[model samples]
Target: MKPVRIKRRFSLGLGGFTYLFVTSFIGLGAISSQTNLLFWTFGLMVGGMIVSAIYSTAMMMSLRITRVLPDHGAVDEPLLIRYELTNRKRMIPAFGLVISELDGDDEYLRGKPHGWVLHCGPRATLQAQTVGWPTRRGAVHFNRICITTTFPFGILSKSIVVTQPGRVLIYPKMYRLRRKALWDIHSRDMIGSRNSNEGGGSEEFYGLREYRSGDSMRHIDWRHSARAGKLVCRDMTRLTPPKLMLLLDVRHRGAWPYDTAERALSFVASLVVQAYMEGFDVGLAVAGTPCPTFTPHHGRIHRTRILHALGELDFKTDEPGSWSTHRARDVNWMVIHAGEIDELFGPPGAHHLSDAELDQWKLNHDGKSSRVNLVTRPRRGVLIADFSEGVS
Candidate 1:
């Protein structure tokens, strides 16, 4: 591991700049009027600005910075990246220190990429945090960690740039999926495949939320709602969904629209998560993009493997999508952009989840949608993510 490099920088803040302007004005007046009071005030203001700048810069330079990346980062979710600052000097202490990310062109960071710390004793290590919500799924590379401060008088701001090479793999955003008709239909096929005593059989009380349109009246928490003065519906997670294999059939027309592809990938990620939670064996078959072959299986490892393939999905937009035309046995395929399946094996579609229907289903509109699901729609004229050319 190469040693981290730290560089210190300083600049005049708004207050410092105003102080300079006032000092100049006062000095001019002093010279014109030959007034000792004005001259004294001008010299004091200039000295104060200088003292503020020097103090802030010295404190910033004395600190050594390091960072801690999360185990895994997901798209559009708050991921806390930690920073540790070590005050190297034996006599001096650090105060009002902040750690920030040095981002490039990607604008996924929601708020200002900085975290604050009240104080750090001499030779003590202090921890701070910066929150980053990845807008898209992929590698989040950190070129540097910027530690900035405007301590004491707050007249000048100083920044210390540390060349820290850090990056993390971020999974695609999982959407809330309430639609269970497709899963219930295929679960019967999986019946007797696993012993009744082996898998999760009964529904468990999960959480409480606002009542939806089609919720069972028996499931409603009447007493709790009456106490809280609102209709609170009871949510549960005791039932399993089903096993599914995703067959992606997409073809690039000309140029790949970035927006369209992102939305499509997000949709896939959401489905995989919902299935896994419901104990579904999830797999993938992409036509164009070069991704790993994930056989249908159920488990945390299997889900990670599928998500890793989705994150590494990258290819020229002009190149059409490709996948083995041969179909897998003993598995129900969930077709996304999969072309006509005349020569293919398995059912044409165990469940055809139309993107249009997903878009039409307003999840927030009292519909019985799953809390752990994703909802996204591609822009007009935007198409193709791991798809091949021409009609399937």
Candidate 2:
């Protein structure tokens, strides 16, 4: 475990101020009227306030918080961030502990996210979870964790600010790809039906050879062995899934560059998931950005690598360059560009999708109808870097 830097802060809450005001008024009355009962009540109220403040301070000071966050998240999905809260003191039990994020990307989040714990006994650790809905793609930074409490009485509140900076890569917004959209790709190649030269599964027969000592008994051919007077084994071929190579061009081609680029990214993201579900080896290459080339492969790790690279793309650092059209044989290439598609680079028969055709390929969140139009509504000459800075 790394060392956590904590800063303690004390605050007089609204209830504290109200209680103090009423107690002061009663103290004044007791002094003016010289009533023993009123004086006792005033003293008791003051004592209670002091005790509440002390209890709250002690409880807050004896607490420790550690954040357990995921490295990646998807847009519109619940990002469950957890925290481990431990009561350090032997006797002071913490209650009503509220852990919140401070100086983070709150605009990208759906609501004011916070974790709560009803009670954490002394010398005990408890885990609390909070959910955050990310609105868009990119990196979300968490600067600090604030643990506050107004325990025992709501008179005073105390907080401990822990400087635990972290980041989560937010993948582009994904949607269900309609079956019609897949039919178009299926027509291009016999997906997942091709046989590879590797010998493994029983899908296709590769050849026959002498049976090895450790060969499976089911693979031995009895008729061939009897004729040859030696044990023979069948070598079966493994089926190779089809491949999808996505070329994402996010260069500034028109007025609404940022929105157009975002839409193209989301479309590619959805297609990546769809292709993986259909058993296609997927690869992604981003134009103008400094992202590295991703080769066509099929696996959960490969898919995550592509998505992470997409999330880290920044137009501000993009260079002026043409799209790489290093076409691989048998790999179905799909060029997805933002705005105009005039400068796209691919084979003549390669699939192409521009801003106009994005909504057609995407399905709604509930998997019902076509996606709503995501075209930006006239942001005249707004630079992509400026727009991203404003959003963050």
Q: Where's the lowest-lDDT run of ten residues in candidate 2? A: 383-392
Model 2 residue 147 distance off true place after TM-score fit, in angstroms: 1.4
Evaluate all candidate structures by whole-model CA lDDT and list the values in order. Answer: 0.65, 0.76
Alpha-carbon runs more than 4 Å astray in model 1: 1-3, 31-34, 110-112, 179-182, 188-242, 252-260, 315-328, 338-350, 360-362, 365-367, 370-392
Q: What's the TM for model 1?
A: 0.71
Clashes of 2: 0
Model 2: clashing residue pairs? Answer: none
For residues 126-213, could you state the per-residue lDDT of candidate 1 as single tens digits? 7788787777777777777777778877777888888878777888776665565335446434531332223222366667878888
**lDDT (Cα) of model 1:** 0.65
Error of 1 at 169 (Å): 3.0
Which tens-of-lDDT digit does each residue in 94-139 have in candidate 2?
Answer: 8888889886686677775787899999899988999999998888
